[model samples]
Target: MSADPNPHPTEPDVRPHVYDGIREFNNRLPNWWLFTLYATIVFWVGYWAYYEWFRVEPEGARSVELAMTRIDAAKLAATAAVNIDDKSLWAMSRNPVFVDAGRQTFEANCVACHLKSLRGKSESPTAIGPDLTDQIWIHGGDPTDLYRTVTQGVPAKGMPTWGPVLGPKRITEAVAYVLSHHKEGEPIVIDTSVSAPAK
Candidate 1:
């Protein structure tokens, strides 16, 4: 007798397990879901290899860096040029455009000692320094002398050396402004007076 060709395949074990009646089914993931998961993993690996793991020197790095440096220098130079032109001696006096600038400078640097209104300190007078609003001259009343006084300073009278700080053009403006203040119809009186030295 020939054995039956259609023999039943061995039945898969389906023993029911009971642990307080809670049961878990042991089933493989669906083909479509498994394939999707595998594709996602593959895509992640490829992206990591291409961007992070790969080593490639960026193109145009050198030229781009050099161009950025030049642009910064040009911007700085433009701003510096404008500042220098605005503060020039001719621009400050004859131009009449920078008078406000000169006035601002005076208010910042001189107001503390000279007073905001260009009036000499009335409460406690400084014997060494001359009262600024007075027509009585300590330094010569000329613009050149006044400029020299501001730039060189009267060390004997405790004035600071404003030349290195204020520069030439600023010094001229500050002096002119001070001189103009004296002639504005207010003569300040002091205990003692000294003649200004010639420039």
Candidate 2:
């Protein structure tokens, strides 16, 4: 037995346990960190149980299932609300609600391909997508054409169909916006002050 309480002569030991010749130190983690770790583990376990076993929570997370549900819900809502015919969408060109919604949707999703300015990246050798600010559409500039284009997408051209991802409401809004930008002087019938959709 040595005079030193620590068996190892050189190293100042912090932990009780030691392996072969190496000393193990118990650098105790902060209370907040330990608490957070434990809390996260508990939360994960609860989430798994609630989502997987009981199925209590709604499908709000970003997943294929949620997207599909939203699409279906939008379709059903559309069926109940309006006819959504080509003329109707074109008529909504001046509606700020639809135009703004479309713009937001475009900015959120289309910006990656279409660029932030709605203009195609001129610096790039190959164009990722068309310059939306321009009127020259590879597909026709009609509202119905835009709607179909957005719904079905030009997959080969690298445009992913937005119908499933964004739902019909947003697609309709986008169509209206595109048509408004395409041609000049459409009826701006929507009353901005009105709380509900104008009949």
Candidate 3:
């Protein structure tokens, strides 16, 4: 093989590494690439120092504990700000949106026990739960009574406490939906043949 007659003298004297007759020149990387590599290393060091060493509290970027505290505070504030009672439930009943939400919530959550028609279960009508369409309620026929019965369920009886399971807003909607079915002065008589368990 003939040697190159025009070899640059300023080029590095470092020998080229050869593998399978392929030569790789030991050249310096481009300035931009080297600058970028250095910049990243410096950025990483600065980032580590700023976050780990110089952390500020309550005002600065929140730590995990501070974030959690703020979240809990927000929860407390929300609970305090929103007041839900019998009047609210009654008020909510008039709203079509709330009624729809309640219906959906019931269909999703309560259908297992209360069934689709808001009466007893579709399979065993009278055995599982009472008919909600009927004006008669074992736990007084008032909005407050219904709220109490639903939120704080009767453990002694088979009913579950749905208030915690479904949040207060949901419970309010549910109560409204249930009460929407109630017709005042509507007479309902259960069979005297068998005393079914209270729903």
Candidate 4:
């Protein structure tokens, strides 16, 4: 026979002995999709190398330092600025300027926790701190005791250091306002039902 010059690319070289038509293809993958898959693999490898492998020690040290700093500040706020003398608080309360400052400070900070009435009642369910109106003082009721409590704070009870946060003059004002709870022109009144008599 003469050499077969025409060849059909679609037709397979081997013909099946029996007749049931099924075919196979040796198709190549699309170039764009294959490139995208390779790029994603490269990105994941680079990310793992930089963040997971390289900076572990430095990151750990930074976290530890932050934790220690927070603890120390809590300790200082709980313990500093305490003198434990009653007269000191009393003296501080007597000053009008100090009392006014105290009033302002109390309004700003304490009212949220202690209530505007200063009675320390019905506002907080558990009474996280103490009742200012009542005579029973935990740390002490005297002016000095009050000042110490106000400035240094009782961290165990979640009372923050107003002295550190605010300053001396503001602390004085807070004491004054607390002292004026029963008196006139105070920022908050325990019982507004009874009107104040003419000055």
lDDT of 3: 0.74
RMSD of 3: 7.2
Question: Per-residue error at 131 for model 4, in Å?
Answer: 1.4
TM-score of each: 0.43, 0.49, 0.56, 0.44
- How far in Å is the alpha carbon of 153 misplaced in model 3? 1.6
Task: State which candidate, 2 or 3, has the greater lDDT.
Answer: 3
Best by lDDT: 3
Please give the ranking of all candidate structures by TM-score, highest first, separated by commas. Answer: 3, 2, 4, 1
Ordering by lDDT: 3, 2, 4, 1
Q: List the lowest-lDDT window of 10 residues for candidate 3.
A: 190-199
Q: What is the C-alpha RMSD of each candidate to the true structure, in Å?
A: 13.3, 15.1, 7.2, 12.9
Model 2 lDDT per residue over 23-90, tens place: 77655689999999999999999998887879886544646688888899987887568446777887
Write the residue-wise lDDT of candidate 4 on 131-168 in tens digits.
Answer: 68655456755566677888898766667978778876
**Model 3 lDDT tens row, 11-108:** 64565677798766666789999999999999988777777667433334457778889899998986665456657667777789989999999999
Q: What ranges in model 3 sit over 4 Å off?
A: 1-65, 121-125, 183-199
Judging by TM-score against the true structure, name the best candidate.
3
Range of the 10 consecutive residues with the lowest summed lDDT in candidate 2 = 187-196
